[model samples]
Target: MSALLDQPLLWLVVTLGAYRLGLWLRDRTGAHPLAQPVLVAIVLVATLVVLTDVDYASYADDTALITFVLGPATVALAVPLHRQLARLRGFVLPLLTAVTAGAVVSVTAAVGLVRLLGGDELLARSMAPKATTTPVAIAVSDTLGGLPPLTAAVTITAGILGAVAGPSVLSLLRIHDHRARGLAVGSASHGIGTGRMIVDHPVEGAFSGLAMGLTALATSLVAPLLVALML
Candidate 1:
């Protein structure tokens, strides 16, 4: 074990191996409703970290190569958006309204709830952009004097919760419009919910991709201003 830990490359191989195992489980289970691959991977990794008594920083160091891919993966979302450009043009106003409204509600509600519960300024700020993607969320948190790590954790939690419950919530609300559903999911959940959307509704998936990109851009521009005003 000490030898494996000493060789950082071994750690990388093991982490990727675990990730692939999780993905294979996702597929083998037919991506079952309960078999969330991200959740599975998180559980697996967490368990391994705990059992091996490996600190998160050490594990993260080994996985930096995988983490580095996130930037390009996020940028790749553009392909789906570009493919749906025509539909996007027609629904521009509605999409903008939905995304803007969702972002405002999500941020405001999170901050308000935390504050009402006696959370400190940092906690409130961290919750401010929990619905946005990691990069935007981290920026927002920093501008607001929040802890970036807390914001990142909140963003991941929000994404996971959204991915798990978004479709059911829409169903309960009787929301049949694919475009509206897609916009809401993307604006609220970011990438994880977008994954579930892609499997359930291709059109919604495309629209969600567009929404995620647009919302990230909008939040990155607006969040700092909002934080400045509030503070």
Candidate 2:
């Protein structure tokens, strides 16, 4: 068993297997929100990690290939966006405004809520980038003198919440446009929400991809200034 723990391939297989189980569970549950594949996989993997006392760094290294795929996947989103370029052209200004406003609101609301709830400044800083993609959020948290791991956890949580509840909330508000739904989820939840949007519709996927990238850039620029103000 100890020897298995030392084998990087063991962890790689475990990660994939866990995700496959998540998919099976999702299918069995009729694609219920609580059974979201990524969320389920996260829970399973984390539980295993805790139970087996796996070193996080080793586990991450073992799963490096999975992480590497995110780059090409993100770039591939542009293909769909390109197909819808003419339609997207008319919304450029509005999209930009939405991204900027979302960035400001995300940072301030996360930090403010944390502080208001009696969390420390460090925690507030970590939460500041919770609305961005995991990589961007981690980077921003480090720059703000917060814990990268905490920021990553918070970012993923935010994404999962958005992916789970975003559509329902949009429906409640009578937002039926795919573009608007995509932009709203992508800006608020980043990659995970974009992934959910892509699975729902191609047009929504394209807009979500665009919004995810723009939100990351906007947050990267906006978070520093906002944190400075808080300090």
Candidate 3:
């Protein structure tokens, strides 16, 4: 019953099972962009949480193990990056410029759109870091006097959107350069998009992992200054 639903182990199993189902669906669907495994898993987990009436706070706490694993997972992206170190060095200057520009544009567009839509300053601030990774976005939102949890949700949504449609969009634009594509996706979508790139294209994923880290640093510096001016 309620007590059974509260077990951390049960939730962990449920989370993994949901992801497994998502993977199966993705394979069955021929790996369509819309069939993204994480997106599917999110949908499945959300449905289950609502059905079980489990509060988000308890669910998150119960699933803390997964959160801890994310740190190492992020660090592991370095393996592929290390393999690209030689090429990375040659592109350092351009990559830095691209990431910084992307960070500025992302913050400006998010904050501007929110304000234009009549959202208050608090909401606009919360939306400012939506393009960055979750932890960085949450921290930036908190520091800007906005709600961290709201920023986290928005950040994840943004990431999912980028992962689902970014590659196709690049293809449409005739952007075939893997480096450029990776930089664009990682700068705009953070870890989730980078994860997609990692699975679909290894070289792109290496550059994407590089961009994700750089975007975090760039956003951290750019957000405060940019938001201050806009607000």
Candidate 4:
């Protein structure tokens, strides 16, 4: 059992299986608000690791394979974006304006919440880019002298929450425009929310891709500057 668990592939299998189980449960529960698959998967995997006495480092080493796919997945979003180039070109100014606002707001809100909750500088910085996708958020956190692993975890949590509850919130606010909904979700929730928007509508998908890319670029630049200024 020990030898089998020691294999790198074991972690890959375990993580995937846990995620599938999480998804199954979420579906079974009719997509309950608190039954977020990623969140559930994390709990499941963490419990398993604790029960088996497996080190986080060993688990992370194998999970890097899954993390590495995020880059390609982000790039794949460009296909729908390309098809909607003309529409994007039309509203460039408003999109840029909104993306800029979202970037700054995301950073401030996350950092502010952490500080309000009595977190220190490192924790604040780690949460600073929570609205961005995992890859970019990790990089931004590292640049801001934050813990990359912690940032990755926070970013994923934010994404999962946004993907699950964002639409309802938007509907409550009477935001029915597909483009507006997509941009809002993508800017604040990153890739996961963007993926959901893509399944809902093409315009939403395009705007989401645009918002995600632009917000990532903006956040990458803005976060470091903000941290430096505050420091």
Worst 10 residues of 3 by lDDT: 83-92
State the lDDT at 140 in candidate 3.
Answer: 91
Q: Name the TM-score of candidate 1.
A: 0.91
TM-score for candidate 2: 0.94
Candidate 3 lDDT tens digits, 120-183? 9999999999888899899999999999989999999999999999999999999998889999
lDDT of each: 0.80, 0.89, 0.90, 0.85
The residue ranges of model 1 lying beyond 4 angstroms of the native Cα positions read 228-231
Task: Answer with 1 or 2, whichever has the higher TM-score.
Answer: 2
Q: Give the RMSD in angstroms, all C-alphas superposed, for model 2.
A: 1.5
lDDT per residue for candidate 2 within 1-231, as digits (tens), equals 899899878888988898899879877987676777788889988999999998899999999999999889888888988987887768989999999999999999988898989999989988999888898999999999999999998889999999889988998999999999999999988888887788778888889989999999999999999999985
Deviating ranges (above 4 Å) for candidate 4:
22-36
Q: Candidate 2, residue 166: CA error in Å?
A: 1.0
Lowest summed lDDT across 10 adjacent residues in model 1 is found at 222-231
Better candidate by lDDT, 2 or 4: 2
Model 4 C-alpha lDDT per residue in residues 89-126, reported as the tens digit of each score: 56888889999999988888777788788889999989
Candidate 2 ranges beyond 4 A from true positions: none
C-alpha TM-scores of all predictions: 0.91, 0.94, 0.97, 0.87
The superposed Cα distance between candidate 1 and the true structure at residue 112, in angstroms, equals: 1.0
